[model samples]
Structure formats: structure tokens, C-alpha cells
Target: MPVLSLAPRRSGFGTELLTQTVPYQLRGTTTLTFKPGGLQCTIELPAKELLQ
Candidate 1:
């Protein structure tokens, strides 16, 4: 299966972002620009190594 995308959930106020794996359906490969909690980071990871 191909790599899909990463949807990092934004934690509540004063809560630090948890480091966890968010699974998604493999549909080829797609790159998305995500900005959570006013912070931005690149979510580029291979499907086989989607683990954190």
C-alpha cells in the first residue's frame, strides 16, 4: 500500500502534542500542508515506516 497523509490532532490549550501514529488509507502518495496549534511541520513519511 502507498503512503496517504498525516492528520495530527491538536490538543487542548496548555496540552502538548502527543507523539502518536495516525493511520490513513493508502491511496498512492500525497503531500499536505498542515498547521496545528499555530505550529507547522512537514509530515513526510513512508507508508512502511509510518510508525513514530
Candidate 2:
């Protein structure tokens, strides 16, 4: 898979933004199924790992 594009912008929320290290987590299920043609998949983080 390839990333098409990314656009970053400042939130202007001040110092708190600079001091925090945000955890990366998945919000949905990542599924992989086998088929005759190929394997289909959906990538995402699991809810159990989202604890902050």
C-alpha cells in the first residue's frame, strides 16, 4: 500500500501540544480474508491498545 498524500497543520493549542507524546492506536478491526483471487485486508489498531 502507498500513501497518496499528507497535509500537516499547526493546531495553535499552545505548550501542551509540544509537551505530549501521543499514542498511536487503531480504532477499528483489521481483517484479513483469503479468497480465490487474493487475500483481502483492512488495517487498523485494536481497541485494547488504545489505552492512554
Clashes per model (N, Cα, C within 3 A): 0, 1
Q: For residues 1-52, could you state the per-residue lDDT of candidate 2 as single tens digits?
A: 5432432243345322332322222345444454555545545555566665
lDDT digits (tens) for residues 1-52 of candidate 1 = 4343554465553222222332243222333344443434344446665453
What's the lDDT for all of these models?
0.39, 0.42
Q: Evaluate model 2: give its TM-score.
A: 0.30
The best candidate by TM-score is 2
Question: Whole-model lDDT for model 2 versus the true structure?
Answer: 0.42
Model 1: CA > 4 A from native: 1-18, 23-37, 47-52
